[model samples]
Target chain A: MLFRRIYQFLIVYCIGLTCLLAIKKILVLSDYVIPGIPLILDTFGQVFRGYFFDVLNTLSVTILGQIISIIMAFAVGILGRKSSWAGSFVKVMAYNIQAYPIVALAPIIFILLGDGFISRLLIASMICYFPLLLSVLGIMASPVKDIEHFYIATGRMRWQLEVKIRAFENLSKLTTVIAGSATLAMAGTIVAEFIAANAGIGYSIRIALYQSDLARILAALFMIGIVISVYQGILETLGAQLKTKWSAPKEGELL
Target chain B: MHLECDGLKYTYPGAKAAVIDNLCFTMTAPGFNAVFGPSGVGKTSLAKLLVSRGNRQESCISTFDIDTILYSYNQERLPNWSSIGSHLNKICPIGKETLKKELIEIFKLKPLLAARFSQLSMGQQNRVNLIRYLLQEFDLLILDESLANVDEALRETIILAIKTLFPGKMFLYISHNLMEVAKFCREILILGESTKQRKNFMVRGRDYTQGYTLDKKAFDATMLEIMNAF
Candidate 1:
């Protein structure tokens, strides 16, 4: 029994080692070069000392834009659901917003806000807001009938439905959508910073690319990928929980 | 309080004749009143008229008398501003908490309060649908073949539960089953037997007006035989 256990452990250990090596190789290819001890130490020092505040500044704009845009989308969606005129106007506006690449929008933001966090936030919101609205509105509109009758029968006002029923029903999808849009918003921030700001990782990446600091460039990519992955994971978990909470399974049908 | 459909009439918009012609009826309040008839008659149409709908082929007609009733409605619209939940609450007047509780316990709609309207099983959704109708106050309840969606077991269960909860409401329950109607509602209106002489009859307890359509010759023979016996 002890020998068999040892054999199983060894096999597990070998598989784990192989997978780690494979991941390490992929990371390096994707610009996460793990060099010898001295080089690793130097890279860590630079990353550790890298302006953590700058990252915070970048995320602040992203969070703000995410919140504002989502709220606006919902507001307009409510209006559109009620009136064809409002809906048409909003649809046209959404299309117009879609026409301009956000790279152009970033310059406008910088010109308007003069290199502050507000400028980046505006750019992020521009990218983040529309997608958030589109996803959530579709989600909200489709599943609305039964809930409407429910609220109507209960005599709940529009406010109660919005706050209690619609919001609760949409909690999962909205969170996941926001989470995904946040990554794109983050990507937009990087470009926007590359164009205007002096601090964020985007600016550093630009500098690294210009000066052939491939090591630092790879490191930054690694960081971005890791952050985005973590966010996506979180969003996925939230969506799964919400789906389970809110939905019923099909019954008596052949699987 | 009774639900009375005064001159309830409806037709598919483009159709030549009305599906329900000059349909006027009264259901005693808080009693099970089955709308008994064969298929393709105006039994379902009568219910649809009472419930109120949107379009010609698909609409419900609710003729509310504001003088007798207290109502708040923006008439010239298609439920645009109302979310599903809000609309439900508006018509029902019982809180969402009550719906949620009943949906969970009695209907066994536990853990599915937030699901999409389309996602539920037909029977489960049927239960939910029944809940929607019961959510609001209407002295008159009109059901148009609503029980067809559920299985026999669920049908019986739902029937009993509705009977228990809505003891004070008027029901215009439409079903094809005569026996089921006898079990629930002794009062029934069987539509579509005569073109010239439409018959009106009453059924009490297990007794049913199992009447057959008679031609002029058959009627003459039957009446002449009755006259001879007298």
Candidate 2:
């Protein structure tokens, strides 16, 4: 899984770089517009270590933000699984909160929380939480009628068991959603850094954009893509393991 | 314990006509009783009404004396993420190991214990589904075509085993097989043939569980009576 993710990202990055180089050649663009291969290579050699650390910083925040969002989404999803008035209210509130654009909300959040790790974390969590909450809500609210009826019929149904049954039945879907949200979390952190933060790859990219250094930007893009890809791959592998372990046979199950 | 329905009328939401209209019956004895009817004759609906924990203000079906009524059907599913053994272990109440073991042996579910629910064939799945319910505590269990996919020999074996093991408890065996119902079930409740003629009533069945062998004359007469209801 990890190898596949890395190769897929590498392929996409190569294609993008090839297109940029082709455009640079056809337009006779200056080094400022699009750096030549040597310049880009030299810039990569100089900034590789720094950008690598910067991306690590961004990734740390992304992981933390994703954890927070995952907890929040599951909590809300479980609470809103029923079709009661409270559940409907929660659904409406979630949809309404997601309606306002995150870009527009970023400034207000920064103003209140300041352009620090907390602000970035909050922004990242906000970006990752809604889609996840929606998916969790969808999977939770939809009853696994086939399994649930037995519990209900036997008068043994409990809220916790209900949640476990639904989550287990839709484990693949939950894992896919979690893996997909990693990108959103990383993007959210980068956007936060680009707008105001001073220490991450996003901030570095902003500085490079201000200096009109296309080579540095390209290097930064490469770092972000590879790191996010690796993170997503790890998550997917973990999900697969969970599914296998769940379905694995129990030894001497007869007892 | 007695389960009686007086003027039971149930119409599904957005449904044009009542599925069960002014239905009335009383089950005074406990054994392998059945609710039998043709396709789309509301056998399932009646089963649901019998075990439903919903509002009873408008419902004429009464099982207030019964503590718990379980309903099991053919298409019911077990949780797929765990093996059938794990599922049974999780749901099986304490001090019921002997009963569970007996049921597992009788249902021939021992081999499939380590298999996940999705890995089993339909017949295997049905056996596992039924076993879980049998392990649970209930006053009356409504088996609504719960053994539809199993072979006739195995189904009969399972039915006889159930009748023998849990003789004291009540079981409502719902099925399309009139012969099976007539032979094994103590009593049969037949619904009307079609939606237009929705008559519901009860008929006595040969209690083969009571050491009565399959007498051809008695079985034929019972079959004819059950068929004539439809």
Interface RMSD of each: 9.6, 4.1
Interface RMSD, candidate 2? 4.1
- Candidate 1 chain B TM? 0.61
Alpha-carbon lDDT of model 2 = 0.89
Candidate 2 similarity to native, TM-score: 0.93
Computed on alpha carbons, the lDDT of every model, listed in order, comes to 0.57, 0.89
Scored against the true structure, residue A140 in model 2 reaches a CA lDDT of 92
lDDT of 2 by residue, B1-230 (tens): 67888888878999998887888888877789998988887888888888774555576776645777888888888887767898899889999999999999988889888888877888898999999889888889999889988999889899888888887788898899989999998878888854546487788998786355778998899999988885
User: Among these predicted structures, which one has the highest DockQ?
Assistant: 2
All models, DockQ values? 0.11, 0.60
Question: Which CAPRI category fits model 2?
Answer: medium
lDDT of 2 at A33: 95
* Candidate whose lDDT is highest: 2
